[model samples]
Target: MSTTWITRAETAADIPTVHTINAAAFETGAEADLVDALRTDPSWIPGLSIVATDRHDRPIGHALLTRCHIGTVPALCLAPVAVLPEYQKTGAGSAAIHTALRSAADLGEHFVVVLGHPAYYPRFGFTRASTHGIGLTIEVPDEALMALTLDPEHPLPAGIVHYAAPFGI
Candidate 1:
């Protein structure tokens, strides 16, 4: 397998493949279902859903960023990042996430929050959200909830994360 991955904004035709990737990556279909629900939700931001493809341009990993809020301030939520089980640990998911975050920055988005593995997300600049006074409505491990600022000029806002309805947070 090539170490390099091609990352790009997900197209309509890539949706089913993305779903399959998510379903296969996780323990259940909930993550895939959440991605499907978020697709039609108002929070869905075009071009923020990204995919990593193999040499033949077949999508093997996916990442999605959706509209959310920190208190009343607008932000983005990174969720359900998935890679094919066979592709796990091959940098496919990381490539898709990096691309999605870059796309968000290019679109002038500032803050992003993710509830994920503390060790995995920090490489993407995510830090313990509670350190910045960021939290969630529901209880989660302080380390599991992380936040990042795409632009250092605009520091991460401190508030409770209000995820999109589909997240059911």
Candidate 2:
């Protein structure tokens, strides 16, 4: 029961464990299936998928970033963050997300968008996407759609987010 989590880029061996974590964290397996689909999609960015491991070095949480666009400008889409049911509220999910975002930044990715819980994403520097003229094709709560700029020099672009094909958005 340690609070510390080891985060890293997901490896091929971790796929099954990541899928299991996603399936168990959500009420349905759609998120898990989406992850699998994204893996083979052209939008897949290597080293953007992250995992948080327990003391035993077993992956208990996951986060993924994939290529997307803001209008025609390249960006990233963060979705399907998942943690094991027993590990929820223990910061595993947060750790995985932070690592994923950091990894993206290290790879020179500048902008990221996430459609998720307002409260949760804001902690990671995500602000209302609408404020920047960012939106989705489909309707969603204003607060749920947020964006972040990894580099202050490059402001978040304003436009409709074009997510990967797996997202079906």
Per model, how many backbone clashes are there? 0, 0
Report the lDDT tens digits of candidate 1 across residue range 1-169.
9789999999999999999999999999999999999999999999999999999999999999999999999999999899998889999999999999999999999999999999899999999999999999898898999999999999988899999999998
Candidate 2: residue pairs that collide? none
Using Cα atoms with residue i matched to residue i, what is each candidate's TM-score against the true structure?
Answer: 0.99, 0.99
lDDT of 2: 0.95
lDDT of each: 0.95, 0.95
What lDDT score is found at residue 35 in candidate 2?
99
TM-score of 1: 0.99
